[model samples]
Target: MPVAQDVIRHAAERPSKLAACGPGGELTYAELAGKISGAARHLLRRGIGPGTIVALALADPVELLAAVLAADLAGATPLIGDHTWDRRRWSQVTAPVGPVAFVGRPLPYAAGPPVRREPRPEDPAWACFSSGSTGRPRAIVRRRASWTASFPHLSDLAGIGPDDVVLVPGPLVSSLYAFAAVHALATGATAVVPGRWPARRSLAAHLAGATVVHLVPHRLPDVVGRSGSSLRAAVVGGAALAPGTREEAGRAGLHVLAYYGATELSFVAVDVDGDGLRPFPGVEIEVRPEAGSSFGEVWVRSPWLADGYLGDAAGPLRRDRDGWVTVGDVAQPYRPGEVLRVRGRGDGAIQTGGATVVPEDVEEVLRKVPGVGDVVVVGSPHPSLGAVVTAIVEGAPPRALLEATARTGLDAAQRPRRWYGVLSLPRTATGKPARALVAARLADGDPGIRRLT
Candidate 1:
């Protein structure tokens, strides 16, 4: 069987089943399969053969997924380039790799079908950018099998099935959206993609009938908090959900599914509503035996772990020969059943006034403030405290909003020392907040905002 035959196989068995939905329109399994085959044939005619590099630069999800599958079927190595990619950087990445085919968008010149070659389980099949939380972006690569292992867990947690229509609001350039899209198609479900995620547009898309929606908590409140929709489930990641936001979404008849995962490790654990976090049946979680190990750094070994970062053949993503891997996330083993609680990313934790603080815990509180759309919390270097908490909020709130949220019925240590407002928080290509960018903006003296600096 071919590498990309899963979707086609499902389509063959359920030709009339719903396969995808997006801004353009809806497509049935039979229709998507036809399009994939057509796309593959087109690539073949253009001389895109086995082992060739194909970059998808289009904005449309249907076309994007179709083109990706086509490249896989035609035996090409598919690398997705974001529409917002820097032309110079794109050239640099593609230059070392040699000539690559373009999909979803028009090419400059015409070519013939590239040849097809079979890829082993270890061959590089996918590449994506780093979240850029700590520094400049780096390329991360994964093998086909490792990428596919997250499918069952993702589908199960999202409650995806033949009858479900999954809405992907984030960009497919990121591993999150790409995996969700592939899972939806492979499971014979409908996947929807919007040109961009705005509050009204997202609500409209869901109202038009999106059974399962993927959103960052930043986007969730705007879509489900005020407007009504036919959404049954919402898988949230990229940021933490506010205390009241999840309850509000639940009131709107949407089951908010919180996803805790990294690009290297697909999904560590998932929690629905307030049910708590649980390990996916497909993965084994190990807690590090270091000091202050309260689900401290989590070590994971899953079938879905990526093969390795692109171009680095020395095997950097590997474990200590014992099959344990880490993406630098702090997790504590929760309760009886080996459940895990994701504290936050290792790099994002801040040391404030001699106590270490996880910004996610604070951001969750800030997000619940009225009029606050999204927020990012970072620890700015401070002489006395070592590091002080600073926050950048997407929406402007009343002067009392910060204090009110800070008084979370908790101690003063949990409150942010500084808060500022911005029109929009800078996000990575994948719609995740770019912490470094936020810090840079603040350093540049962005005016018109309150600050406790």
Candidate 2:
């Protein structure tokens, strides 16, 4: 069944239940159903029908949710775009999927004929763009079943129910938060979204009523500092959580659940403890070892995999004849229960003096150093070594302190050859470090970089 139908079912059974809430407004199940019906009629009148691609650029979370459902009800595939996108970036992203219509705000309720088309399980449901931190973002398409199929397992794992209120503090443009909101609505839970980016005040207010929250690891420190409510669970992903960060979150009264996944593949492995992640129920995992390396590229086979990218950029979604797909993340099985220890992305591996260095390994060690807030390890150009491991730190700590910490924690090749301190590091919308931007700044000798040689 289409996800919209779930909302319709909820409206029939629980008309007075809160469906969504935000600073701008709140919606009961009945009200949300009415809005979705009206929006569907409006979309149909505008000539948006089956197979049509509609781009929604709205910032309001409630309105965005309604618009997406309405598009699906109208038999149209919704492509959600960030309203903050500038002209150049927007054009680069939407160019692949040819535009049909753009809706930036909620449409008026029209008393017109109801949309009669029913979306099949295989029908295209939604399209979301990649983070594009490495390059231009690509549009990824997924079928309705791709998400709904995993709802039961995910809901069980998340402990979501009708009484639960799920807080999604990030923008709808991010697939992570988008999934949180949609999954909440689909499962009869109330989705609480923030009105704006940064989401400090909005998050605090919603946390008072929210039972669960979706957060990126990098944002956890700030959120834990501000949040006072004791949540049942906090879902953290998008980037690796630094050492001691989970413990700090626990001290703040939040139980953290970290998972590893990609845009192409939905939820792959979920972190059971500090060691690594255990595969999601029913999901198959395999680690194909490289010729001369202990770590292997991680492959996943699951019902939640996306169909493919919308346009010509299809090379990254590598698949084999057996229906298994990989996003180039390298890992190894650490336990018998299908647990995996992710090494790093194969593309991000750095070759230095005939040795391979995963930046995440160095970053993990550096994060344990005192006074270090955040760290991103990258390869910088060197005279002898092809690339020297460099560490970019958020706060300006003495070189002696970092060097001392590295001496015991890291191997000789894994140690950072140079350190640059800055007030902050560049990050994507989802809070992952913007490696490309950081590399450019370092290469161009940005004045903000304090060289601790």
Candidate 3:
């Protein structure tokens, strides 16, 4: 069922219960349902009814959530517009939607015949912007079941209840936060948006009334550092948590459930505490390696993968004949129901001296070294070998620790031959290394990066 269906259901069960809390104020379930119904009716009035594709340009977090739910209520697929995107980027994403209806902000609630409609499992639900490290983002269109099907998995992982407040620090435009907000609403838990304020550290400073918080690994420090927090559990997604970060968060009484998922693949795997990642509930993982290699392209079979790219017809999301999908990620051979070690994207693989090396394999090992803030491993052109493994380190960490760790933790061919240190590395919105910008800098021989060896 569409997530909007749950919102409507929750209103009848707990009309006076708090639904969402933000800087503006609070919305009880009845209020949220009323507000969402009003917006949906307004959208219907504007000809954005069943199956219509609507682009939401709301700035407020609460407004964005309301608009998204309202769009679903009206049985239209909602695309969250990014403020950072240019006109060209916007056009590129919505091209396949075909004559999209634009909703600048949520409209005032007006009483009328309910526009509520139950969305089909395969019906277009919403569009998610890919976390494209390559600088180009594709709007991945998701189906109603793709999201609603994973609600049970999320509920079990986070252990949220009606009284529990779920905190989403990031903007709703981020697929991670969007999922979190809707999940809270669907489960009848109060959704908390205590970030995006002047300080921006509002999340680290205060968690509002959140008992279960969803955030990326980068925000763990601030969240753990916050005093007088009512938070009991933290769910970290987007990227793996570093050893130091996990330990630090553990010391603060927050054992993070770090999830590894993508815009195309909803919840593939999750690592509880510090254990290795295992397939999420109802997800199957397969690693197809070369003739003799241990690491191979990771393929996933899930009940909730996205419907595929919307705007651009060309992308990496591939679904094979056997119902398995892959976004080109490479990983070590996975044992069913056990630890799955993902290396990196297959396209990002490095072949140096006939040996294949995944940058993520090197990056993860380097991140474990003390004094190493961040690392981005890439393949640089070499005369003899096709390409040599290279490492870009953030901060002037002593070269000895990096060198020793690489030699001990990695194979001879996988160790980075060239090392460069930067005051800070270029990063994406989610705090991951900006592979495209870094590769461009390396290609241009940018002097801003100090060559270590």
Candidate 4:
């Protein structure tokens, strides 16, 4: 069954249950189903149906979820566009898809024919753009079954149930938060999103009844300090969770479950005890050796794999004849099927002198240094080595502190040759450090970068 239909079924069975809560206010299951049905009729009147793409640019999370579910119910593929984009950028993104109608806000309910057609399990239910931090964002299309197939496993992993309310703090355009919201609805749980992105008020307001929260690692520090006692699980992803942040969350009585995945492959592995990531139920992983390296590129085969990019062009997603796909991430098996240590992306590898260093490996070591709040490692231009490892730190720690940390934790090649202190680092929408932008700033000699070497 389509996820929307599943939500509707819940409404019929439990009409009084709370389905969602946002800035707009609380909505019961029956009310939400009515809104979805009304939105579907509204879209059908606008000539959006099977084989037609509808672009949604709503700012309100409640409206956004309703519009998406309505599109599926109407048998049209819904592309969730980023509301932060300006006119030109948004136009450029949707030009290729050529959606029939672009709705930025809630449409009026004009009594129209009810949508009777249901999308097939293999039909494209929704579309989302990649983060585009590395390059241009690709339009990724996912089939309905791809997501529904993993719902049971993901619900089990996160302990999601009808009684639990899940808080997703990020924007709906993000795959992590979108999955959280949709998963909650599909499982008859209430999903609470902030009225606005980067919610201004304390997250405590949204956590009154929420037990689980989906958050990026960068937001964990602040949230851990102010979270309510009801917050039992913090599902951190979109970036690596720093060791300090994890410890802080533990001290606050929050169970931090860090997951590792990409847009192409959903929910690959999850870390429950802060040790390492183990594959999800029914997910398969294979690490094959790369030339001149001990760590191999990680490959995944699962039921949750995306169909392909929208235009079917070759991009980061590489697939073999047997259906295994890789996003160029390199890793090593710690306990085969039990734990896998992800080194970093193959393209993110920094070649310094003669050795190749993954920035994530070096960044992990730097994050442990005293006075270091956050850190990102990138390759800087060098006269002899072609490229030298560089560390951009959030706090201004003394040169000796960083050098000593590097000396003990990293090898000569992996240790940063230069240290740049900054008040903040450029980040993507999902709160990950924009390494490409940072590297460009370093190359162009940005004035804010304070060299400590």
Q: Write the per-residue lDDT of candidate 3 for residues 160-215, one digit (tens) a residue.
A: 77788888876676688788889899899999875342254565445645788887
Using TM-score as the measure, what is the rank order of every candidate, best first? 3, 4, 2, 1
- Collision pairs in model 3: none
Best-to-worst order by lDDT is 2, 4, 3, 1
* TM-scores, one per candidate: 0.69, 0.75, 0.75, 0.75
Estimate every model's Cα lDDT from 0 to 1: 0.66, 0.77, 0.75, 0.76
Report the Cα lDDT for residue 308, model 4: 77
lDDT of 1 by residue, 224-275 (tens): 7434566788887644455677788778887888867677777766676566
Residue 155 of model 3: what lDDT? 84
Model 1 Cα displacement at 371 (Å)? 36
Each candidate's number of clashing pairs is 17, 0, 0, 0
- Rate residue 155 of model 4 by lDDT: 79
lDDT of 2: 0.77
Q: Which stretches of candidate 3 lie over 4 Å from their true place?
A: 84-89, 132-134, 195-201, 291-293, 346-453
Question: How does model 1 fare in lDDT?
Answer: 0.66
Question: Please, what are the lDDT tens digits per residue for candidate 4 over residues 81-132?
Answer: 7776666777776665654467788866656555578567767887776653
Of candidates 4 and 3, the better by lDDT: 4
